[model samples]
Target chain A: MARPMGSVRLKKTNPATLAVGVALCIFIIYFLIGPSTSDFSASRKATAAAHHLSPPTSPFRKPTGDKQKPPPVAHYNLNNVTTTPNPLENRENILLLTPMARFYQEYWDNILRLEYPHELITLGFILPRTKEGNDATRELQKRIALTQNQGPEKDRFKSIIILREDIDPPLTSQDEKERHKMENQKARRAAMAKARNSLLYSTLGPATSWILWLDADVVETPPTIIQDLASHDQAITVPNCFQRYWNEEKNEMDERPYDFNNWQDSPTALDLAKKMDPDDILLEGYAEMATFRTLMAYMSRENGRLHEEMPLDGVGGAALLVKADVHRDGAMFPPFAFYNLIETEGFAKMSKRLGWQPVGLPNYKVYHYNE
Target chain B: MARPMGSVRLKKTNPATLAVGVALCIFIIYFLIGPSTSDFSASRKATAAAHHLSPPTSPFRKPTGDKQKPPPVAHYNLNNVTTTPNPLENRENILLLTPMARFYQEYWDNILRLEYPHELITLGFILPRTKEGNDATRELQKRIALTQNQGPEKDRFKSIIILREDIDPPLTSQDEKERHKMENQKARRAAMAKARNSLLYSTLGPATSWILWLDADVVETPPTIIQDLASHDQAITVPNCFQRYWNEEKNEMDERPYDFNNWQDSPTALDLAKKMDPDDILLEGYAEMATFRTLMAYMSRENGRLHEEMPLDGVGGAALLVKADVHRDGAMFPPFAFYNLIETEGFAKMSKRLGWQPVGLPNYKVYHYNE
Candidate 1:
């Protein structure tokens, strides 16, 4: 039998070629599952929960049988009342929490313009996971350094905390544009809920007396906003939000779209809430509702003249302030629908479940940036 | 001639192998000189300079002859004389600059303990390029976030800034330890001068009235240190630096290793300066000196009892405050020897050359941390 010399040579080369092929496979595998990969497994959630500052039992623990009593309607003032300024000795320590994705310079400029004492205002920023967000955060950091280094203006921020990480976006296909928009609404809300909860859980300290949740897009607010909110001394309080849009037809400054999240319980809303499945969500602008049940924006011109105090069943995150004790007692932003509501509305519901009333200021309005 | 079939096959394989080898070389080259490489070239320097807030100019500009008149001997009080507090309208903004390689928590804690109003103070930190330094800086950032989120004590900082980058180490060889030590000392001083100048160039703004250089290792200082220094109204002022060493034999706290940089132009020092080449550097603690010629530690008991003001030819970064106008007028920390001194001492020379006297608080001391 003739020796198969070519076969012998091929066999010798096989191991070397096989090794190269194996390395290529390994490289591809690593690239597929690297640090950039997103993981939302139960183990990861447990890990996140374990890192919380407070001992985690159940984030939404009911206040036992004694607390089953219905919460009384809350009333808060929106008029430009001369808020009794507390003496320096008894100044409340306010931790301002802002979940932001953009507008670094304007936010800092507004913060610099705040009339409150820097010694008492702790600024905390939670940045989302996006190139835009990261860039904005870096810009803010440089500004902070610049102001601290050479700005003649006093750097009056009591303390500053900035946390940045990626927040997952809603899953959508390019082909289904309409579905994408609808799904994105819920997805963005869910992502925001996660961001807010993570920030509050990780950063909230025992020394904080109040927590102020301010949206990044709200550009103009009175310097005394913090003081005014704190003076109410309520479980939860939110100011009316109005957008500042250029009146295209009139060629002058005009109020634009307003936030309608601040609302009182209406029969139509209650009926809509009842019709939805327990796991289904009820969105504000998407839900079918009568004109009377739909909560409309509080116009700027009508501010400081309406009812000083009003009951609010649901409130938006534009400018909400809550006593630290309310959160410490176990209230959180429920990401999923707890009672046909989700996100901030769910948070309001959770707060009331613990016997804390939710109050809204109809007349006191903060200006939102035109989108 | 008979065709060599095996040789023909070998030739074809060789070309393929050569092509693979060339491809490997190109890949390795790209990886080796990629974006992650640390470069200290003129281009990189230009890039760094470009990032500066102010227009780039020679950092070490000499004052013209008309400004050569020796500044009038400055007199400042260090005694706790009932200082007249400036009214809110007249309050001068102070920028506290601390270039640190370590000690994040202590620096912030000490900063929080400062008695100055947060509205008037701006905190700036420059961290060196080292693994330890970077880690400490990250820890400080986390602590800042934590304190603002959770700390019960009021956040008292007006504004905070942190800068991070690698500074080149002094050139040295392992063969010569003694020479390495000497060269390293000069190198470190030069490096510190560069860092200080860069920070000042990037952060200094028109609003700043004063720049305070405080070392991170200073663990204890009078709460009213800023007020006391600002009250002097000198072009440049430094506090006496005394290290609290564990007195092993005495079993009590004792000041050992005092900062000798703060000094008068003694005949011995002036004579030494004259002998050295203009390019050579003069170091503290190395030159021969008598007890009186060397300015030693100002004992706590001796504080507020010595000459309220003493002429200082040089000062340490431990605690030096300079009027903003001096920096605005082009005074800088010269990295090279000027009058046979460099860094902080060179800075003193630069300031003096511009008709600004350097003042020393012989009776006021700030405690250095026990290393």
Candidate 2:
């Protein structure tokens, strides 16, 4: 009778304990699985915010937190994604990054004319905190809002971000002669490098498959510029940047080579770099700082050979395309001299250092604004 | 007999279920509390690395991860910290930030002469990737390693960081004439702004209470320079920067104003800024780009009036002291034109915009190296 009574008491408490255990297990599982799924979505949204758009507040706000750690190095598992011959069908996302000091209406118009799927292209711009930059920012925001909110879905960019540069540009003069002075090249390029890095680091996201560095002054290109560049599938590719001007004598638009940065280093150039002061930057297209290198702009012929590609030792920022992995693998415009080069040329050196080839399309022309 | 057997079965299962429950509870609690504590420590270490040292691997490597999020905004709970009149007894941590394109042994020696508590000082340097910068970096590292690892404990700084600028400088010439050229001022200042920002952003940590922007060429100051500057507890402060040159005519050392950037904006300057082109930058010390402002460097007297503070509209980078909160509040050297100004002057403008008063000690002198 005592044993039975003890067992009966045990039986009474067993149901309550079992019920609590079942409830606890369900709660634990829900918490374990639930947050991860939510976290995935939350992170996706954050990536979009980081790379594509800025909140309405201030774009220049420093990311906060005393315990904030540097982000983990990014790795893209491209093994799983099948590569198709046609980039259009591959559905790769391209981030178009531009560092704009002055606004050009023609540049914005040219961007709208690109044949790439607007839904797949994310646009990013880093502007100076100048009156000109302010005006440009306002105009750009207005245009983006109108197109993104009011225009047809097909015409809209997937996302857009406008960042006001945190640092002031040393020289704000847009005068072409002042800009092209060999004396000012080092400073100009260094500032440009900072702008590019700021834009790239701030906006490059996990979804970005490729990065397109388009200058604000690049006003003309083939409507299929994106497809043409992406189809090459190279680590880095740049089209010859040229400018068309009304010739007073001919009365017709005359084409001239503009971006001299795209070039293959001659022995003379390499020798120059070797002998030059580590701080002395070797600039292209200057008589004073001569590096007898072949220019891609001059390589173009009258007839179309748009697909003609040549291996390049250096590249210009104007209308350049790069794979996201190359950047992830550590290639950026050096604000400081790299191998006696800075900015785009420095980036080329950095890319080569990382075992990535930089190639140029000699006959593939992109027209720069006639300053 | 049936009921007794059922009771006996319940008794046998009771211990097993209870044991399982106990084990599950223990596992859950361990996971819940364990990771958070470890995360705290790991994050602390990450902060140290991010702010004080770069790993042996490339410092330029981009922080990885597709799910990377910008750090949360840092909030310093200073309400609990008591404010003492004497900065020496305040136990405040000061971060000395310097942007160097060239290394001067005198500057390093002067830093060592500072009377601030070595254990509370964290030093940071950002050098360009130029040959000059390389030499400077190597020498700086050698000096730092010797002092940090081999020197007496009291002589050792709390921590030190050395960073190579990511972008190439636009101008690398150390020639005083070339550097001070009015045409190159914008570009030079812009590049300097970028370097300063890069160093500030990369090395600033939660532990920092104040920031001292000491230029590499500023080779002389009072031994208690840090204490004198920090004691003011102003949002922003700058000492008069002057230079001593061999006076061939006087047969003695002659003093002259070095940093014209430290000034009180005159009505003429403000009017000029208002009338100037949006992108046009107003530079100091240049006759061509003249703004008739009252310079702090010219206000210093022969005798000891070292604590005379005056309101200022602009401040130079040579030897500026600022509360960390002023920086954390978003006052940075604008690389772009801010009210027709850039770099250090632009920083003063930005600080004012953020509601922080910028003050100058006209009688407080810090000697700049004569170029």
TM-score of each: 0.39, 0.44
TM-score of chain B of 1: 0.70
State how far residue B37 of model 1 sits from its true place (Å): 34
For TM-score, the strongest prediction is: 2
Tens-digit lDDT track of model 2 for A1-371: 01122222222211100100000000000000000111221121212212111111110111255563322111112222222235678676677988776677888888888888876677777666556666776777666656654554455665555545444222444454544556766766666675666566545543356789998878898989888987887889899988788988999989877777788998989999889876788877665555778777678888967798999999988889887656643466766566788878988986785568999999999987765
In terms of docking quality, how is candidate 2 classified?
incorrect
Candidate 1 has a TM-score of: 0.39
Q: Per-residue lDDT tens digits of candidate 1, residues A1-371?
A: 22232232222211100100000000000000001011211111212111001111111111245633221111111111111234123555566877766754665777777666654565666664355655766776677555533343334344455555333232223332333244544555555665665455434532345678887767787877877766666778788877666788999987643666667767877787778775667665442333233242442244265436676777788788887645543455655564666668877876675467988777777876654
The alpha-carbon lDDT assigned to residue B96 of candidate 2 equals 92
The segments of candidate 1 whose C-alpha lies over 4 angstroms from its true place after superposition are A1-89, A168-180, A287-296, A299-303, B1-371
DockQ per candidate: 0.01, 0.02
CAPRI quality level assigned to candidate 1 from its DockQ score:
incorrect
Candidate closest to the true structure, highest DockQ: 2
